[model samples]
Target: MIVEGKVVKLGDKIDTDVIIPAKHLKYTDPSYLAQHVLEPLDPEFHKKAAEGVIIVAGRLFGTGSSREQAAIALKAAGVKAIIAESFARIFFRNAINNGLPVLACREVTAYVHDGDEVAVDLRSGEVLVKNRGVSIKCGRLPELILNILLRGGLVEYLKSAVN
Candidate 1:
């Protein structure tokens, strides 16, 4: 899958709590949860994300609790993909399970600025910074993960298999 979006830059160690604070977990509605995403870090994050973005961040992005809500909220908020130096293992899986494309490209954050347009080829692990005419390589998603994302998450993939 290939995703293109404007960048939404964030720093290292952005935790699940900041992704979707606990106070808002009471509501399972994704749109509602999306309204508060990264509230602690950036009050306008949800607004920016709503415009469709590719989050570029430093190491340990998603380094907190194991709530899948974090991934859900991001996807619902219109985060097309995420490129970080590294990601918490659980969050990585959750993102794929929720059909949110995420890649770990250490060079991405430094090269791409907020609002810069980028195109990501998940199958090739290539991130193309449109404004700079640069391409950075990240670890390619395995075929299984790619398949899941293509089908729009795990549940949809599984359902298709059973048919």
Candidate 2:
């Protein structure tokens, strides 16, 4: 499972509300949430990140109320992957549960830049570094979690395991 896209760098300590403001949670449909991803903070984000972008953020990312909608909105908004220094527990689970890859690494912020073209290979556990056409070695996830991602989230993982 390798997700590649243009990097979109966000600052530190961004919670769910900041990712998708709570005021817009009235609708239950994922599309509704997707349309307004970061709409409040940056109205043009959707336009720029139309084809799925790789979001890079600082530590303690996704810190806030446990709203799965936040993860849903990101997926719907076409954010194929997110690389953060760390993730709130619930948010981390929610992301993988929904089939969107959220990776935690100490130096992700250092390796990626806004608009850098990058690919995250969960199977290999490395965020393949691609910048100005240059490739570098960076954060690698655990093989255990990589297997979970390949199965497409925990629910699917469980189903396969049970079967």
TM-score of 2: 0.85
User: Native-vs-model 1 lDDT?
Assistant: 0.90
Candidate 1 lDDT trough over 10 residues, lowest sum: 104-113
TM-score of each candidate? 0.94, 0.85
Clashes of each: 0, 0
Task: Write model 2 residue lDDT over 20-47, tens digit each, in one string.
Answer: 8878877758888887878768977776
Backbone clash pairs for candidate 2 read none
For candidate 1, give the lDDT of residue 68. Answer: 89
Point out where model 1 deviates above 4 Å: 161-163
